[model samples]
Target chain A: MESDKKIVWLASYPKSGNTWFRAFITALLNNGEVDINNLATDGIFSSRRLFNEQTDLESNLLYDEEAKQMQGNVFNHICAKAKQRHLFVKIHDAYTYNSDNLPVIPTQNTLCAIYIIRNPLDIAGSLANHKDDTLDDSIDFMNNKQSVFGKQEDEVNTSLQFRQPLLDWSGHVNSWTAKLPFPVMVIRYEDMLADAFETFKQALLFMGIKTDKQQLETAIAASSFEQLKQKETDYGFKERIRNTSFFRSGKAGNWKNELTSQQVSAITSQHQNTMAKYGYI
Target chain B: MYYYRGFGLIIASQIMLPELLPYTLTSTPDVHISIGKTPEKLTAAGTVHKVGYAINPNEYLLQFLNVANYYAANGNNIIVEPLAGSDEKSVRLFLLTGVMAAILHQRNAVALNAAAIKHLDGVVLFCGYAGSGKSAMLTKFIQNGYKPFCDDVCLIQHNDVKAMAAYPTIKNWENTFTGMGLPIPSTDNKIRPNLPKYATYFHDEFDTDALPVKTIFIIHKDHIAKSVEIKKLAGIEAFAEVHNNVYHRLQIYPMKKEAIHFQAISKLVANINVYQVTRSSNTGFDELFQTIQKHL
Candidate 1:
C-alpha cells in the first residue's frame, strides 16, 4: 500500500545542485516560505540520514540478531507519518538500490529522480573553501580516493586522523549518475541558472505538482540566491549548517576562475564523456 | 619514598587493577611468577595455556595473526572461537570464549548457540539443523520486515536497561541478493557487504542500539502437510530441541566443556518460549511465521 505513494527521490553524487533544488522545491510547496533555518530538510529528498541511521556493521559482540534487523525501518515510520501530507524523500547515495540492498520501501520503486550535475572543477573549489585548503591541497587529497563522501554537507574530520579525502571528483560523479533503475531527469547547475523558469516547470511536471502564475512567481522570488542566504541568520533551524554555509558562493563559471589549468585538465580528462553527455563543457 | 602496607600484599607499589583481574608482576625468584593475562584470552578464565589458533590459506593465517596481535595489543579482551572443529578442546573453548565474551560484554543476557533476528516487536530466535529453514526463515522474516540479528551463531547480552542483539551477517541462499528483489535487504550492502566476497546473502539492517528477546522457533524443512505437528515444547524437551537443532554439532572441545555449555544453554532456554516445528510441504513457513506473529 505504501509503495503506492509515488516516491520521487532527489539524488546526486554529492553537492550537485541537490541542496539548491531542495530549497527551491521547499519554497514552491510552502508558498515561498523557504526556511533557511529548519535544516532537517524534512524527510523528503534526503536519503543520507536514512542510510546513516539504518546500516549495520560488525563490532564482534556475541550476537544480537534482532537489533541488526530493525536497523533501518526509519522510512517505514516516516511513510506512515507522511501518508496524509507529502511525497518525495532525499537519498544522498549514488549507488542504485538493488534487491541486494532492499530498503523497507524498495528504493527501486522510486520512479522519478532529479539528478543535478555540476562542473567537478567547481565542486573541488567549493570543497577547498569549506575545508580552508588550496586547490592543490584538495586534489592531493582526492588522489588517494577510495570511498567518496555521500554529501557535500558531510563532515570530513581532519582532526586527530590526518588523512586524504575519500574520492576524486570524477569517480564521485560517476557513482551518483550511473545505471539508475528509474526514469531520471538530469539538470545541470548552469542550465538551471540560464533558464530557471524552464527547469522549474520541468521539475514541477516531473513531480505532478501544479502551480499558477502567482504561485510560480512566489516560489522563484523566495528561492532567489541572495534572498534565501539572507534568511540563514535568525532562522532557528539554520543552526545545523552554521558550521559550513550550505549556500557558499551560489553561482557558476566560478570553476573557471577558481580551478588552475592543470586541475581543469585533470577533471575534464577524468570526466570526459560525462561532461560531453551532460553538455557541461 | 613512603609506602603504606595493607594486607601485606605489596599494596604500595603495584598499580591496582580491578579486583577482578589477577596481576602478578613480581619477578624475584619464586616470588616473581611474572604472570600476565597472557597475549591471549582466558576462555574459561582458569586455563593454563591459552591456545592461539589461525586457520586459513597460509595467506589467510598471516592476516589473522596480524589481526589477533592487533586485538591482543589493544588491551581489550581477545578470544579465539572454535572454527567449526573436530578437536574436543576446540569446541569447548569456542563455547567458553563465546559465553565469556557475552558475559563480559554485559551483565544479563547469556550467549547461547542459536540464531536470531529482531522484529518491530521483540527478539526472536530461529533454531534448526544446518539445512533446516533457519536462515531461510530469517530471509523470509527480513523480507517481511524482520531485522536480521545473527544467522547461525548468536551472542545475547541483557541487563536492567535493555536486552541487545548483535548484528552479524548470515549466509542464506547462494544467488545475488538482487535476484531476490527485497527492500533494504538489498539496498544496505553499500558500506559493508554482509556476505564474504565469494559468498552471497550477507548483511542486514540493524535496529535499536539493542532489544529484548521474546520467542524461539525450532524450524525443520518437513512440510506441514506431511503430518508434522507444530506444537509448544517445554522443559528438558526444549533444551534438547535447542541443542540438537544447532546448526552444527558441538565441536568436541565445547562439548567437553560440558559445564559451561550446559549452563549457558540452560540460562538461555529457561527464559523464552520454544517450539518444535515440523515443516508441512503444503504450509511452507507460513504457519511458523504466523505463529511468531501471533505471539509477538
Candidate 2:
C-alpha cells in the first residue's frame, strides 16, 4: 500500500451539496470534461457491495454491529489496494463508534475529511422532494434522533448502500466537526453556492490537492448548476430520486417558497443552537 | 452422523443440519465432512490471501477467525476444525454456507449466490447480492404454489442446464414471515444473533431433486422505480451480471482458477436465459409477483 493514496472523506447530510462537490472535483480531475456516470473517486462509504468485495462475506448475513466493525477493515483494505493517489469516499454516516468502541471510519489511513452542511430549512424542502414525502415529514425526519437511511427490517435492502446511522441534523454536523480524530474542513452549502470558486478552492486546499487557477476556474464553470442540470436532463443520473431530477433547484434559499412558515419554524426550533451557530437564523 | 442431500450431492456430516432435506436413500457421499485437526496457519503455502479468512491454496487451507477452520483436497473431502468456545450450530452454518461453496468451486462447479424455485416452466433462479430479495421472492413464489428448490445458494450444472438444490430452508427477516401472515418457526440460531432474520425451514414443499433452469432473474431493488420492470439481458452485460453473482468468486483469484471459472460462467450465460428484474421499494409482493408471472 502506497502512502500517496490520500483517503479524503466527503461527509454530508442527505440532499446537501455533496454531489456538487464531487462533480466539481471530478471535473477538475478530468480536465473540465466530466463523465456523469464515471466519477473520479472510488465509491461511496456505505456501499454494501464494496464491503462484500473486500471481506469475501455477505454483509447482510452479519448483524449491523458486526457489519460496522468490519467497515473500518474494509476501508483499510481498499486503501491498501488503491491504485490512485487520492480517493474521495462519500459518507452519509455520522462519525460514531460501533459496539466494540471503534470508529466506523478508521483514521489510521484517513488523510482528512470535508463536511458539507446545508441550512435545515432548505434541506427540508430538498429532502421532501428527494424522499417523495411532505415537507413537514422531512422536517420531522431531520429532527428525529433515530433517523437512519436504509433501515429495512421487514425485507432485505437490495440497494448498493448499507444502513447508515444519521442521528439528526445537529448530531450529523457535530459528529464530523467536534473533537474529530482527523482534520475536517467544514464547508457550508450556502457558501458553495454564494462563492463557488473560493469555497471549492479552499476545500481542495484542505485536501492538499494542488491545482492551477485555470483548472479551478474550469472545474467551477463545468460544474455550474445550470450545466449540471442540463447534463442530468440529457442523460439521467443513477442517484436521482423517483421522477425527480437529482440536480433539482440548486438555489440557496428555495425553502422560503417551498416550506410553510410553521415548517420553517419547526426546523429552526429543532436545530436552533446549531443553526444559530452556522448563521441559519 | 447425519446424511443430507443438497446440490445433487450426499453430504455425511458429524453435526446435524436440519435445514437440508433428508436423503432417505443414498450410496456413497460425494462430499465428506468430519471433525479433524486444522492447522492455525498453512506451513507450505502459496499466494496467501486474507479476507476475514485466510486462504492458502497451495496448502488447501481456509481459516476463519475464531469460528471454524477448513482444509479441502481432491474436491471430495473437507476437514473441519471448530474453534474454541464456538457452538456446533455456528460452526455448521459456516461450513454449510462458506466452506461448502468453496469446496464446490474447487470441484469446478458453477455455483451461484442465488435462490431457486420450481416454476411451471422450469427452475427460476433469483440471483443477486445478499438482501437483494432473492429469498423474499422465492418465498412469494412458494406461497403462490411453487416449490422451493433451494435458498441462499444454487449450483448450476451447465452441461445439463439444471440447477442443483441446496438447503430446503430459506432465512428471512421476522417481518417477512409476519407480512405473509405465516408463523415464525422457532430456531435456536439466527443468521447472526444481532440480525433479526431467522431460518425458516420448509417441510412439505422441499424439492430434493435438481430442476432444469428455465430462466435466471437477477433481482435489484430500485428506489426510483415505480413499478416492477423485467428486462432481457444479452451479450457482455448478461455475462458480466452472471459473473458478478458467482458464489465465492473471490476464491478464483487465490486458487488460481480464473480460467476454469470464467469458462464455466460463460457456458452458463450461453445456455441459460438471464434477465434483470428491477423491483421498486414501494411495490407490493403480490403486484411484483403478478408482473413476473405476466412476463413469464
Candidate 1: CAPRI quality band = incorrect
Question: Which window of ten consecutive residues has the lowest lDDT sum in model 2 chain A?
Answer: A152-161
- With a 3 Å backbone cut-off (N, CA, C), the pairs that clash in candidate 2 are none
Q: Give the poorly placed runs of model 1, Cα more than 4 Å off.
A: A1-3, A39-41, A44-77, A84-86, A96-105, A140-145, A150-168, A171-179, A233-244, B1-296
Question: TM-score of each model's B chain?
Answer: 0.50, 0.89
Off by over 4 Å in 2: A1-5, A154-159, B24-28, B35-38, B42-45, B58-90, B119-122, B178-194, B203-208
> What's every prediction's RMSD, in angstroms?
22.8, 3.0
Indicate the residue-level lDDT of B73 in model 2: 61
Error of model 2, residue B228, in angstroms: 2.6
Model 2 misses residue B249 by how many Å?
Answer: 2.2
State every prediction's TM-score relative to the real structure.
0.43, 0.90
Model 2: C-alpha RMSD to truth? 3.0
What digit string (tens of lDDT, one per residue) describes model 1 on residues B1-296? 11211111122222221211132445321111111233333343322221122111110010111111211111122223222323322222222233223222222223444567775566788776544556657766776876666555554442321234333445543332333453333423322122211112332344434456677788665421344467788889888876664322222232233444456556667887877777543444556677656655
* Model 1 alpha-carbon miss at residue A170, Å: 4.0
Query: In candidate 2, what are the lDDT values of residues A159-205, reduced to their tens digit?
Result: 56788999999999988989877799999999999998899989888
- lDDT per residue (tens digit) for residues B1-296 in model 2: 78888756888877777877677655988877788997666555564555566555533565655567887665677789888977666676677776777777767777888888887757888887775678877888889888778888887775677777777778887767777787876656466544567787775677666677888889887766778888999878988998888787877677677777677677777877889989776777787778776655
